[model samples]
Target: MNWYVVYTKPKWEKKVAEQLKNSGIECYCPLITQIRQWSDRKKKVEVPLFNSYVFVQLAESERNSVFQSVGAVRYLFWLGKPAVVRDEEISVIKKWLDTSDCIDVTVGGYQIGDSIQLESGPFMAQKATIQEMTNTHYVLVLESLGCVLKMKIK
Candidate 1:
């Protein structure tokens, strides 16, 4: 048996995992407790490590049970089919989730020679070459326009 990704309805990961577990399907729904601060109080809430999804282990023969038995599983994209999630990618995600805190990571800025489409600020809707990358910004040179613009990327 291997882990398969099951997409649940928005904000239904915990519910789905619980339902799957009750149905005897092994499910792993990693959760983290985050402190929520208010004006005069603080509370902890268990949130899913990954939003709107849970992992299940099943055999090829039992794959049908996922959709038939569990109403939570909306669809599964298999090999050579539409929206197929690669096994290697899933393995990497599992490995990282095992070692890390499993929070969403967002990366900003552009790499060298990466064609960038500027969205906002003075250089809005401009395409420029990333000349250099600094701590929080990139130096862009608009060759055709003969203008240099430094944009901050958060």
Candidate 2:
């Protein structure tokens, strides 16, 4: 079975993961504890690391089975096909979260959903969208290349 990306309803990642698991499907929804401050107090809550995205491992023939769960709207597509996540990449994500090697990163100007143009490097002059910003990497989607880039930032 291959791992495919699933697009869920906004703020429904964890719920969809639990629903998938209840149906005997193998799914992974990475979560992180974040501190939220209210006017009166602050508390730690578990939130999905990737908003509205979850990974599921299943055979191609069983792809549609994911829709049985609520909030699973569709499979994320790349290059006209369902985006597939390699097992090694998934393992690395697990390892990264488990390790306490996080460094404080101060990102200036750019934000998620921003369109950026590269001025140099291999993809120089190409335009990409900032899909995510993590402690060690900037996740970008180069539409022209039909690929996602996890560029490590120092």
Candidate 3:
């Protein structure tokens, strides 16, 4: 069996996986806990590594069942038809699930002047400049009153 990525409805990773698994399809939903801060305090929360998506192990012949049987599942296309995630990617995720470290998916082609918010740290809530972009983080610059501030965002 090969692994295909399925895009699901918002906040429905578990639900979509359940529906697929109940129909005899194997699925994987990896999650990581991050510290989220509110106006008052910080809280730890678990969130999906890949938002609104899950990976299912299925043969090509049985792929259509994922869309027909799992109501929450929306599509499985990458460039064209169903996209098969690389074996190395699946293996890395499985290893992280066993060890429980933070996991993330990279979004490509993010350009300068693209609107972005700081995901964490001291610069939270202040509008900033995406001075530079990298595979894992951005070089952000912020202006505080009359002074300049800078930080890296991941």
The most accurate candidate by lDDT is: 2
Candidate 3 local lDDT, 1-107, one digit each (tens)? 88888888888887888888888888888777789999999999878877787888888898778885544555566667767776655664566457643434243
**CA shift of 33, model 3, Å:** 1.3
Which runs in model 1 stand beyond 4 Å of their true positions?
38-40, 68-73, 76-154
lDDT of 2 by residue, 21-135 (tens): 9999999997888899999999999998788899999999999999999899999998799998878667756765676664443446998999988765445566889999987
Where does candidate 3 clash, by residue pair? none
- Give the per-residue lDDT digits (tens) of candidate 1, residues 7-97: 7878888888888888899877767678999999999999886677677877757866666444475554556442433344455445644
Against the hidden true structure, what lDDT does model 3 obtain?
0.66
Which pairs of residues have clashing backbones in candidate 2?
none
Q: What is the lDDT of residue 84 in candidate 1?
A: 33
The RMSD of every model to the true structure, in order and in angstroms, is 11.8, 7.1, 11.4
Give all candidates' CA lDDT scores: 0.64, 0.83, 0.66
Model 2 TM: 0.69
Q: Could you tell me the lDDT of residue 151 within candidate 3?
A: 26
Return the TM-score for each candidate structure: 0.51, 0.69, 0.57
Of candidates 2 and 1, the better by lDDT: 2
